[model samples]
Target chain A: MTTDDWVAIWLTAKLATLTTVLLLGLGTPLAWWLARTDSFWSRCVGALVTMPLVLPPTVLGFYLLLLMGSQGPVGQFTTWLGLGLLPFTFTGLLIASVIYSLPFTVQPLQQAFRAIGARPLEVAATLRASPYDTFFSVVLPLARPGLITAAVMSFAHTVGEFGVVLMIGGNIPGQTRVISVLLYDRVEALEYTQAHYLAAGMLVFSFVVLLGLHLLNRERRV
Target chain B: MKNLTLLAMPLLMTLAPNVHAAEVQLAVAANFAVPMQKIVAAFEQSTGHKVLLSSGATGKFYAQISQGAPFEVLLAADDETPRRLVQDGQAVAASQFTYAQGRLALWSAKQGVVDNAGAVLKTASFKHLAIANPKVAPYGVAATEAMIAMGVYSSMLPKLVQGESIAQAYQFVSTGNAELGFVALSQVYEHGRMRSGSGWVVPAQLHTPIKQDAVLLVRGRDNPAASALLGYLKTDAARAVMASYGYVH
Candidate 1:
């Protein structure tokens, strides 16, 4: 591929990376809280967070557009803070993707947190370590595989995202035009050869990311 | 007496088998949705023929037809596709005719944003411009032509946002995702008046004529329902209906 083609690849990588990081940062605490909390309200909140997994991406993007419109509450608040409109912009795409891929990261992390068993934390507390210290020094080490899985899954999911990104990003070339949207445009223009190349690339990319993470997890266990 | 009446019921059923309503599977372009619905309703009312309308982008329909879909008629968004179908012998030669002419318009929900002379695109104040994917939608090509004619293609290329089709292009600007968008005139015209918004009717000098063609597929060449529908589209009444929707006869 030429420099122009690489630009799209680079932007896609950047967007996917940012989305995965954001999801992890937001998801890690929420997953831990959900895993530890026994309250009914916490469980309800957990369920609500997982809801995006089942909802169609297009549906999510549609509501997100309304929420991010200039007249909408979020838009008005952001405008007051000097942040412009959200939809049809790169930052808007990042926000949409973070929500769309939240479950992929959150679910695995939640399961990992649950598997760690409160025993480690309890022991650390008895030894006079703070809750944050126990989390960083003990719980995090044990849940390494789960964290890896979450990051990889989230990144891979964001890479393949289509409907939501298309709806919100508006397919601006060299800006919001990721590989999936580019592939779609190629097909629409009857450029099937280019579309095939991009589709094959995505399939291979997803497989590699998943396989590499799984392999690393297996190695860590052994 | 009961046995004789039972035998007559079966005889009547067998005799009327050929008179049952037949399905006319149609692959129509998305822009023609409303007009096709009216025409289908009128056709069914006059001839009792059942039609199953499948609306999508013309390129998608063409792909399906090439793959041997059981569509009887193709109401394509452009003449070139139908003409190609004729060349491929996938459609009848004489059956191809321009049903309506598509008109491209630059529309914005924001009042006074677009003038009929397309003075808005010359200004750099607009942040985003929306148009359908030029490779697929006919109106998209027209939009690009208008931009190129206005000498803004190079400058505005970065800010252009492409929708998959004309309907979605309209949605992008109508929902205010983009400041303005290029879309089909039919999308905004209602009840003999333009919808509450400003739109610039693209001049013919900017682009090639968008002569939309409707053709009977090879499978429907002899089908009664397909023939009837094609005939109806050529009528003055149908032309008038299309005109109301901003289609040129």
Candidate 2:
């Protein structure tokens, strides 16, 4: 592969890692609240959170372009704060990726949190643990698998992000050009050998990771 | 009576589609989309051929054509792609011809931002200047060439934001994501005036002429609608629409 190809791969890795971290930080509270609450508000928010799952990336990208353009309210607010436009920057792509992969992070984490049940929290409370202590000591340990799943899914989804990035990303090298976008560029530039390398590498990488996870899960279970 | 006859031509043309109506799939360059749409509508009305128009970057179309895409004809943004297609044996060499002469423009969504002389590109006032991917789109190559001709290519390199196609480059300028951009003159032109925004049409001498070409693909062989569509492109009716959108030829 070319030097640009390596740069693209590295950029994608950074984007996915950062997106996973941000998703976990943001999604944890949202998923925690959704899991514990039985209010109608929970359902509404849950549905809203999962909306990205069904939304075509192009649609999200379109709305995001409008919302983040200079004439957009979000743009106006950012410009008011001296940040300028957000659509073509890496920060813009990160925001889009976080939104695009929110559900992928939240759903798994929510399910994990729900599976932990109230029993551990109740036991910890009976033992004179504070709410924070109970969550950190009991609930977290029980939800580790789900946490891993959420992080993995978020990272993977961000790595595969194409449409929204294509719509909003300006495709600057080492800034917003991820592997998928670079792969697209290579194909369009008629460098099929480079395209083949990127495509085959991604296929192999995804398969190995999945296989590793399966064996790890089996080992833990045994 | 002459004016009335001209008006009635379109009306009579609409009635011509019922007999021997057939569909032709076309892969058109994204830059030619607006003009191609008008041409398709006219062609359908006059020739009874239903055009399934698929528009995108010419590079993508070349890849698909090589892979045996179901497109009967290709209207490329660059003459090179059509010539390459013909060389690759994906298209008939004899069927290719220049369809339009594309013009590049320095444009900005904000009024008065882009002067007639296109001096804005030399200034560092604009944070991001958008252009289509130079490696893929012909208009992008022209934009870079224009910037180079002005001795501002190196200076403007850092501030550039590359769009996937000229349409998207126009979008970046239109949406004000980038303060200014290089885009197709046709995108901003209508009835001999810019539709919106301020623009400076780059002189043809600054860059290699973007000679957009149309060619029949191997897939189009034996398809009456495909040949008819190519024939329609050279007609006065279609040429008029092309001219209205700032295409030179």
Highest TM-score, which number?
A: 2
Q: What is the lDDT of residue A78 in candidate 1?
A: 71
Question: Would you list the clashing residue pairs of candidate 2?
Answer: none
Residue lDDT tens for model 1, B1-249: 999989898676555434755678998888788877887887676556789999878887776787788999999899988888888888998999999998888888888888878888888878788898888888788889888988988988877888887777877787777789888888887556678789877887788888899999999987888887889898887777788888897
Clashing residue pairs, candidate 1? none
Runs of candidate 1 with Cα error greater than 4 angstroms are: A2-4, B1-20
**Which stretches of model 2 miss by more than 4 angstroms?**
B1-16
lDDT tens digits, residues B59-136, model 2?
A: 989998898889999999999999998999999999999999999999999989999998887777889999999999
Candidate 1 local lDDT, A46-78, one digit each (tens): 888888898988899888877887656777777
CAPRI docking class of candidate 2: high
Winning candidate number (lDDT): 2
